[model samples]
Target: MSVDRFCETMCIATIAVMFGCVACITIKTPVGAISGIQETLTVDGRPYRMSTFLGIPFAESTAGENRFKKPITKAPFLSTFDATKNPMACFPSHLGGEIKYGKYVNFSEDCLNLNVFVPHSFEKNVSLPVMIWIYGGSFVEGATAIFPGEGISAFGDVIVVTVSYRLGMFGFIQSADGKLPGNLGLWDQHLGIKWVHDNIQAFTGNPNDVTVFGESAGGASVIFQSLYPGNRGFFQRVIAQSGSALAYWAVHATPNAEPLIAKKGCERAPDPVKCLRALTPRQLQDDDTSAWQPVIDRDFLLASPQEIIFGNSSHTQNARNFFASLDLMTGANNFDGAVYFRDVWPFIFKTTDMNTFNLTRGQFTGIAIPSIIADAIKPKNHNIASIMGKLLDFEYTDWQLPNDSATLLFSLTNMSNDVGFFYPVVSTVKGHSSLRKGKTYLYELSAVPTTHTLQTPNWIQGSNHADDIQYVFGYPLYAGPRSTGNYTEEERRLARGMVTMWTNFAKSGDPNQPEDARRFTNATWAEYDLNSQSFLHFTNQGALPGSRFEARRMQLWLDLIPTIALMETPQAHGTGTVHVPEIIIGK
Candidate 1:
């Protein structure tokens, strides 16, 4: 039989068997009654039973008039809803590619749904901690089917819910006159959280004890959600991995939507939103315009995320206080920049083979470093950009081997790591820990996987972006035949340790507390503070506590660079050395 026929036959057979017996599990949520599938999964050579409910809608269809507007909460189900399979993914920014689980998802405009996974052990009156996952695709592309929560729910002993929101222009499009305020995607997430907080009890989850966690853009999205003034009590704790609201790529203050509107023949229309809505999703998604990202629309975001987090103005004090009230865990991979650099290499360096790309010092300072600063920082003025570029070139360069191609490659990779991932993540941690009201923990994943999923230059070592995801989700313990890669014994142990710690943090306010501390190499995760600058370092051998991660380099980006950028004027460039002043945090 063909693959489609085989799949259809197996699906019909499975349904027949389920109907023949009392195998299906039904739970009555606030919306209505829904049925899910119960399956047995093996983790660490032990069998566990869990129930999975997929494709549960949280909001109404976001097609036509609702395209660029806030999502309306999904009404109660008229009858029993069969939520056994994954929902169609939101219209992706790009066309034709498999998402996380090697599944080619169908696209739809009405794709605001969520999936719930519950362990059979805690499917009754017991109240278990809940974890809501948001996938990251730079706010342009992502699907709920990517990261399945079966392993997390079964092994971590917490109820897991993965949410799906709108993507690309359909999710974020704005007008100068505020006709289409951006961040409709964010509003969709807010409604999903609210739905869970209101109705998770049916799945034996504690709404009060909930943790919102995500990686990459999802990580940034969680941080953005925490900063939103209206989400004061939506979730109690947050975990952001390799992404931050302060990251330059995460937020676009003033995105130009006119090009896309004009491309769709809507420029002449008095109401661009309506005109664009009239076109099919394919018509809009096929345009060559840049992907739509989050913006400061005064509704979802009152101002810049950085300003709201660290600013001392009286108006921002309440936002800071609310942000500080929630427990936060944020961190980045050691070589997070390698993945980003690899993607942008051909465009900037004019080469795909980075290993053979011999870079010169002149080109490094003139073409390479300047391009990175301009792209990442998006400095307003030429003078500011020029000053920042010179400062970075001086800081990132290896004086001893300045002319070596390999050394230049390494330096460029580190520069990307710092300005993009490390600086933003550390800055967010600093702002949160500075308040001292909420418990905060930081980490760095340096453990290299034996089997590499992402291709990087041999010179670049350490964990790349999203490398920590598999271990966190316990992929090794439950990877099936169609899984991407196989895991060794060491990887299995690492997965166990990571899942234990991640779930522990969700249960209580601490990762090392409430038992299973010894599973994570028996290392106590120290709470991050300005004094020690402590963080948990995950290595190949085991988890170890470290202090002042890349102290000198961090000082360069956080303290020295900002200070120089502030003092240097247009005429100061190439004139003489500029004196850098001390910057006190929270002053």
Candidate 2:
């Protein structure tokens, strides 16, 4: 039977099963028949009917013996599966006092499901572009429930799929031996993408046209997925927002699995994986204090992301060539640094309120700068770390207003922004653009939301980390349960423009192509090159094209600091410690 006829028959069968009492849609996928629910979404004054297939298992449950191992593809179902309700989130790992997206409730190790949202207007013969979303919660906490794709799917005219993967110890735990190789989370994501590529055609999605996009750690995952030699044809384009694989926190050279294993009384076991598997999920999750991140397993990652993306060795060249084959779009927010200050100086500041926070010149010079340098740079040599810190202190200090607390706060925020978000994102674009193969576009989100959710200090001036997510997903038009506040008309227009640009990129390699989409902004987004460094600066007003975002700051971090660190030696500092200059408060 034809695909359209088959879909019609399946929908009829579903209606017959319910005695025509309920509205439902069913599609006969390669694996089995799945039933979905139809919903109405209103954009502007028009209501669009959307088909939502939720909680479809892409892979088998990673419980019991499957723990810490690569996810296996889920077997076919015997009967029509219900894809109406949201799936359970993977067990979340606790981050001490870190404000993440949602509370962990109704979680399980069997949470390897994905959700599909399609426009109801699409027929089975219509081939729509597919955009898969991978969420970010610092690789610890995130759920498909929090990120509803109905808005994007209905508005963008594309098939949207949100994927859920294993998290924390359940996903990234590794053994000292190779028995429990890490990166199970990445493997799960791979399987999810594969399942979508194979079965999306049944839902009127083009298998060959796919774009994978994500934020923060999810952004880093998009890069990693593109870097994998095996994923050449899995995706054609990638959009990484506010995250890069080269960031210090993105990949862990040495995973601290011993401490967690010892805490669980599995340190002395004959087989660590077996011992850990024997424990209950609660026992394993409650005591997992270690920061579980992706390790450089020889299979997934041959070397560090830095080595693969920046190194000139033959092996790295092959990886870079593969990465360059896909169209890339990446960037970060303007004030992304504000989020890291709580952890960077936990001793000095207990809260994000700058009015209550106090700092002296001595502390800023002697302690704060050094602490941030150590955290951001992670220099191998102690002398290099000290030198970089001293240089950064000199670069960031506002000499004219040395005693002003607001100035100090602004300076610190700038320093943190460069180290955490700006530098890494710029570096990623540079690496991709240098190859001169596939198209690369860069952007910086400078629009501060009027409706605030994060506890950003009043002194901070620009968008905080993850702030751009709302506009990208058209959240202003359709705010779900996690709505921060009511958005303004301007914000709604920005959301419409953002959705258009993002969907445009997914459909074609360029964000400006097909020029007939509702034009909210007159400014054209320029392609990023190494020399020009052109980027789109997103603001509440609209997108404005600019060149060399933070040109001076980029030079300081990318060129000057590294050069100084390389040239300086122990003798330069004398006594193995650099002496910090005293700055009187009144002076």
Candidate 3:
């Protein structure tokens, strides 16, 4: 939906914590009055402050027959529910009008609502550490009021939030006989991270020091909310930048909700979820969102993320109760495969405004190999789709960009950004570094976004998808040519070293500590084990953080992509060579 204005930009950065407001100070909030303002955040050049709080109602008003069910949270109101505007953007309806920031947004279906901020010099018996953003439109068009949260809650003191769920197909649907229990858009992001872990400690925050981050389908909904056992105490650490939960469009469902509620006329009606919850949200935003999203539910996607990443859970007992020791930092974005290379740019110049740049390689392999082998479920060989288009044209045949149709549009935009976001964020950091019970970190962002919005011409270079959200939320300060609207001493030293390494990994799960590692290194960003694949590489020519000794073409897309890897366990399948597939199907 609006990844920095469709891979471009128009400058909209504010949200670095708020801490104060000159006058409007009304407090009391189980569900009401939340006046605020006063924000800043310069870090390493100094300027702190925090307290923002806008549009607060953690839940309630899901609108009409509670629009397909499950998120209630906002109840006890008494009036003054103003919280100073900016909260409605949930009915994206699968991006009709391609949804570019929907006229600076306000769309609603009573949009769940959330936005907290906090920082101004703590105290009230101190409690900080909290961060919760979850934006990414493949869950059918994002919204958390387009994330801004005041410079990482005043340059990393902490307590920052951003939420709002339910998208395309009104937050995913189901019912071939499942009485309608699809993942209510992941239970509206698990009731907005359980209403901020039961009311973010009245805004001082520290509900077991929460952390839940996101990007691209909100980083696969922070690995499906760290694979719920009913989300133990809401959150405790996860960052998943590019995206994961083994993407092939992160677990698509669709067992047939009768041709998706018969595109909203309510198929064979008689209460098709109350005749598709009384239509009009522009007729469910224009239907066909390929049967909405995320399924396989016995209650919130119960199994098969290859049986919850290979512990093969039929139901709890094993699989470490769905691995929740939870310390994760996941990564992505080396041109996050240029968001599927801006729709194959006229199929790599073979042109289509009614033909002509010359099209052939068997007509772009008969239009991109039968739509990437009918969107996944391959490997039963029989020349698995010409051996996956010659193993992705033999590792994305690059002949150095700028010609041959931008090198076949940079090898089909890094094979659709390496099977949708770097082979599922390096197979979800090799299944949470083979779960020792949490402790994993890895990165790779490759900067260079001095504004782009998919202009798609000048040989397209670094940083693509969601160009590192204004250097991880401190915003525009890349102030070089003494540019007035600021930010450019190398984008203010990479937004004060990525908002102090994402608020020192949400206040200590280790982000190379020592005040976010004294402006980037004396070393220590390790922990991505299975032996030194130690990454950190966040560059725009700053370089340095780079040791990556593993990549036999990412071991042939994690041993021959049975739909983007991740389900390899069994003590790492005897050091990889393929052979690993118990179950994997299609979208």
Candidate 4:
């Protein structure tokens, strides 16, 4: 039974015992607090109250004139607010699909409200660590209410906050005229963090111990926030899963390119906004315009993460402190590259049209591909076989494409992919090593596990994109889709190990607690350093000590300089560390 139901039963039993008659007792929350009609539940054996306040405005809804503009915080709300119902999602079709998932609910433009979960007996003085999650749908399609925990209040042990912000075009659109603003979604995160910082103490969470975490796009956002000048102290630590600074869809303008096509589709509409607003959510989904993403605003993203890490950018102000105060933990699922490489091969395969493919085959061969491979493999000190073995595995069967096809494709794909995903991660790990030596952790998901499903009895495979989400959020195993049959029994065990590691990290900067080893042999997690590059390797049994992943390949890729230059501000150089490119030539 849920905690609320259990509490109600006990309350009724208490009344019957005291009065010698069964009676209904009025259970109200503590005065002046965000109240819920729902009864409180016990957390760690302590009575904890929970509440969800729907539609507490965070910004002017991004509809009509407000479209493409930064969000404005709502004026203070008056009167008691009841958070009993699920609020509307941030303006529907932000992700271009209606009921994308059968359960995907639609929300609104004025969707600035947040859900607050607090334990009933939470004392004002006992400061709990806070975890703020930024849900990912490639920068779209997430609402504050849809996450697994039911509401922010469900996390009785720790103060958890989930935000509802604009997504896709409504959140991250940019106009060529420089008229349309970018990253409204990012601004919403800033506002949300600020809100938590100002008010979480009332919920018994420590603002100083805040750790921002997310999966996929949300993971990328956490990395982005780590490097954003305006975001310091808003969060002290970050946990990123799946999405990375090196991924192709992440760094290139491709995320926005599709919308240009959408703009073309919208150009013919009688009224752009009205047509977009009026179309059946499905029709808008068909328009293909919703892929808008966060771009460098010169204000929030002073430079792309590449320039910051390579220490090659000229712009400095508002950027110097980007990595100055961050403590980080990040990793990728084993098969993240599976779905990742599939998505980009077509671009490389159809490179004849620069308008469509962007880079020519020769450009890919002589410059782009080579540059990327060099950076990814860091071939200077290693042989081609050694570099390829660790960083990439080619197959002669279904996995291998004849001749140089696979090699070229892999290089092109991983080039941008590494920069977008791994590079930022490496940079973050390294930065923490230099700046916060005692407090950084990195992990790699290696195990796959079996799970039961309605259609099949058991299906399992290695970790794929977003696979780590359930573990990190402590969401129930049966909540969403199950894994494939190929996944090992050990993968499930690793998932539990991951949860403990994350919660432990959330409570304190260190990922391993004193008792972690009791649960699994790999309980001892070492802080990352350049020499050890220590990282927790997730396997069937649990996590184990690991280092040296594609070392030669990674080294080779570090030799070449990044082609795209970093954006510059006036005060300081935005570069945090020098990122040299290295390459590996596949034999």
Candidate 5:
């Protein structure tokens, strides 16, 4: 027999003898020889001792007829499948934008794989809570393989799962009739959770105690899944870091399906769906033109987020179950808006690469203000706009410090952050606290860890968008955290605290209630509600009781801007409508 074949046969025989039962187990013999199965795992000679199963397929191929359709769960493996390596990520998707930082990654369509992590001593009867991680890339990028789950599983004594899903046009190209359901990416995540629920017991996980968590777009996707009626009981708790379903960029209000289909040459076909099926994945991804995003597909989302969350739903509000029993822990960074305005500062506003994209000053003015107010206040048929520009200038521009260069830049960044991130986070906290009987905890990440790579000025301290991901995942993780060319003891200290709080929330409904949780060693994170608007401000010291300063800052967008426009309605333009009252800050 060939040596390779002999080794494989022996490996299979060992596996059969050691794992005769359904539950996973590996036996080591006394002769200093590994027994009948795949043997031990280690990070050097010393072992963290976690049983890691990587690149396990969770769903069937999303190619051919499966394109733009819901995920179909894969059949059980008939033999030993090597899960030590990661599967190819969904095609044409960037691996967490690593390319921007001079890193390359594998990409392909057959990428619906999941990684499972459990303590080495884990037994099926021990039912540890499960935490499933979803990554963020504006629905365009990210993968599960980049994140390690073993350390977290060992740290919290819980099962950790990192999931991969379809991204870009492959997952979000919508169909006008809802026949080709566009939430394939979401459905992929849903199937992953369901798979874990059904099969995690074999690996020593409590299917009933699952928590979904992520940062940036991943955080927003958490809210999307929770609010949807289909995912009501899928997860027991949530940790949304630096993102929300209500964030302007989290979920787009419009559908870009028709344009996408047109790009695929299906606009004139008798059956558009059939034409879409004929094209290859590369055809859909080429030219990078697809505006793939979540839309108000009546199936997944019966109505828009505004209608459902803001009490304008078609059904009685009481009939809906919005986090009725689920606990929530969500928050954003202090300078969350810095990256939003990194390029467009000092009066240039915005520019485009395409020559046809040029707009005159008046037209550009409308684009500068919050999108909700721009069109409503813009003068029509004049090929120009002014009212909103003047209003925002009056509101955000610093007359007292007009000469300072960074003042206007900082002002715009703050406005963008509040409009897109902070306002929505606070709104979600308030909504859950008011609607649900379970505990709701909120936090703000302000630690400037030495690992942040985005080159912002020193003044822009506190955390920027998605900075908490590094701290929570650990600075010296298996693959190493994205560092900022330096290290400090205090930053690593902050990381431990963040990870503890997150895992505590996953293990128990309330983070602070988790007995002996590393975070609770210092403070009691108070529940956020309408009364105090309390939050935990996470710094090097620890999670501390912090008063919200956003109430006044958000007033500029939710009150002053809209109210002033209402007061000056006719003077700016007779076409201005009062329909924007819905944008008012929730009380």
Candidate 6:
């Protein structure tokens, strides 16, 4: 070989070696043997730590005989599996699956797992508070080891855990024959929370002081856990961002409402249990996408959260404890329902514009006639147009959808937030006030900066739905957090403020001390009252009080549809097809 060639080869080898070292160092953590892309850092002058534990099993795969059954806990972490590398997210679909910005992560049906982060060297006995985050993808899609979750773990000194639950048909499946039931997805979450409550202490967390927090579907989970009888005592405090139980797709407004129909508008299959189990995951996903929801199985979920909220259920404690006793905080991002509206508009209406994706008044009253009523009467009718039309007025059913699809879309988007997200939370607050459990604080965020990545077309600014997630977790965005060109300082402050408030709330019941009672300068957070419903408004200027901030919009929802809110123990709601424990023969 020529001398010149030898030198070039040697140099190339040397650079490759150097690059390998950088990758190793970046992926490995500085602490003990725990794995999965660990990072060491500090928070509040305390040594903080973060790591992603991809695909740690929380439940056995719900395939074959296991289908539709409650989640079965996995044995302790095995030494054979490397906890260090991000596992393929459990199957059928990956996290952020099919989204434009989707990242490639390993996904599988065996993907019931969670990620955890903790501060380094907190006095061993300190027993720092633990925050378990449930990601929101309308309960159909999302993963624990996502971007913002990792960032949020970095923002706090407390132990942070993000979980991945089963989604779509794999998670929720209502039986046509009433032999097989639904809500297995929610039960999976309950099992995971039970795992946390039982095992978080081993990881140096205060199991008793745990706070369950989530956005969108996740936010909905927090409300569910609080109200679901099976989930009582799982977490002490709750934080729900952008979704609620008293909203649409939650539960029906009236009691003894029709049963949630099965896939393809079928009420019951010939061999409901065996037939559903026989279908492939893809078959279920495609067939069951229309009404993926948590059901009020008298066993697991005694009464509907709606019934509990209205104080009309036999399980009064379910309502009382969820809304009244616990320290709870819930809010919605302004753009919470835009994506749904955008997607559903075209499917429901005949003349929707592909380019603009807006619905017309004529389309609303005509082709869209079934869409409105169909949505208004969910589960029971699912995709059955005839059944939904029977429940609501043909005129009121279609009504004049807003002239601009944006206007109607905005209303519909917020409807879920108002009815499903905000109203249930307020009802819980009001219920709590009646019970005299503790003070309930309400807030609304309305800062629309031009900086953050403007993913939605409606507006380049304004607090679109799920915007709070970016700020709450302090995740880096494409546009940064502001258009002011000041970079991420304000965003960082907001993140810090949120984390601090959340952690404090987890540690104690109250998020605010006497001195730091309000969320921010522009707002003096107020306890919710039935007569004077209000919320602390968060904007660039500061936080202040706003009356009936989200309630008025949702009130019309009550006018339009009836509902049932359940808030008591399982045994109380009578026989509404709840999941009850069967006798264990040998065990």
Whole-model Cα lDDT of every candidate shown, in order: 0.79, 0.77, 0.66, 0.55, 0.65, 0.56
* Tens digits of lDDT, candidate 3, 84-198: 4567778776556236777657687888888887877333668888998988877777666566666656666788888888876677767777766767888888888888887
- The alpha-carbon RMSD values of the candidates against the true structure, listed in the order shown, are 5.8, 6.3, 22.4, 9.0, 7.3, 9.2
TM-score for every candidate vs. truth? 0.91, 0.90, 0.34, 0.71, 0.81, 0.74
Taking the tens digit of each residue's C-alpha lDDT, what string does model 1 give over 1-587?
Answer: 74434444454466566544324566678898777777677866788887788889999999977888899999998766777766778987656322442364677888999999888834457899999999887777878887878777788899999999988787877778788788999999999999999889999999999999999889999998998767777789999999988887787657557778877799899887788888888777753424477888877876677767766656566676788899999999999888865667666777788767788888789987877766665555788777788788888898998898788878988988987789889989998999888899999998878655567777767898878888888878886432455677777777788888899999998998686756656588999999999999887778899999888898887877676656543433332222222221100
Report the backbone clash tally of model 1. Answer: 0
Runs with alpha carbons beyond 4 Å of true place in candidate 5 = 1-47, 92-105, 123-125, 286-290, 312-319, 341-367, 370-391, 453-459, 477-486, 515-521, 558-587
Model 3 poorest ten-residue lDDT run = 7-16
Off by over 4 Å in 2: 1-22, 95-105, 121-124, 286-290, 342-344, 347-355, 515-518, 565-587
Quick one: ranking by lDDT, best first?
1, 2, 3, 5, 6, 4
| Residue 192 accuracy (lDDT) in model 5 | 85
Local accuracy of candidate 4 as per-residue lDDT tens digits, 1-587: 84445545564565456434332322232222243323444322344344333444555566656655777766554434334445567754434334553354545556776765543443245787788888777665666565634222243246677777777666766655455556778888888888888777766778888888887778877777777767767778888887654443443232353354365476566655444555443344434432556776677776665556435444743454556456678876655544433334444454332222333345544454444444343344335424344333331112343235444444544544354455445655665576542366787775653432111101114655566665554343222222232434354455456666775677777777623643744558888877888887787776678885545544433432222111111233234444433211111
Best by TM-score: 1
Tell how far residue 582 is off in model 1, in angstroms.
18
Q: Of the candidates numbered 3 and 6, which has the greater lDDT value?
A: 3
TM-score of 1: 0.91
> Candidate 6's residue-wise lDDT over 113-176, tens digit each?
7766655433246577788888777666776656335444545456787777776656765554
How well does candidate 5 match the true structure, expressed as C-alpha RMSD? 7.3
Which model is ahead, 1 or 5, in terms of TM-score?
A: 1
Q: Which ten residues in a row have the lowest lDDT in candidate 5?
A: 28-37
Q: What is the lDDT of residue 59 in candidate 6?
A: 71
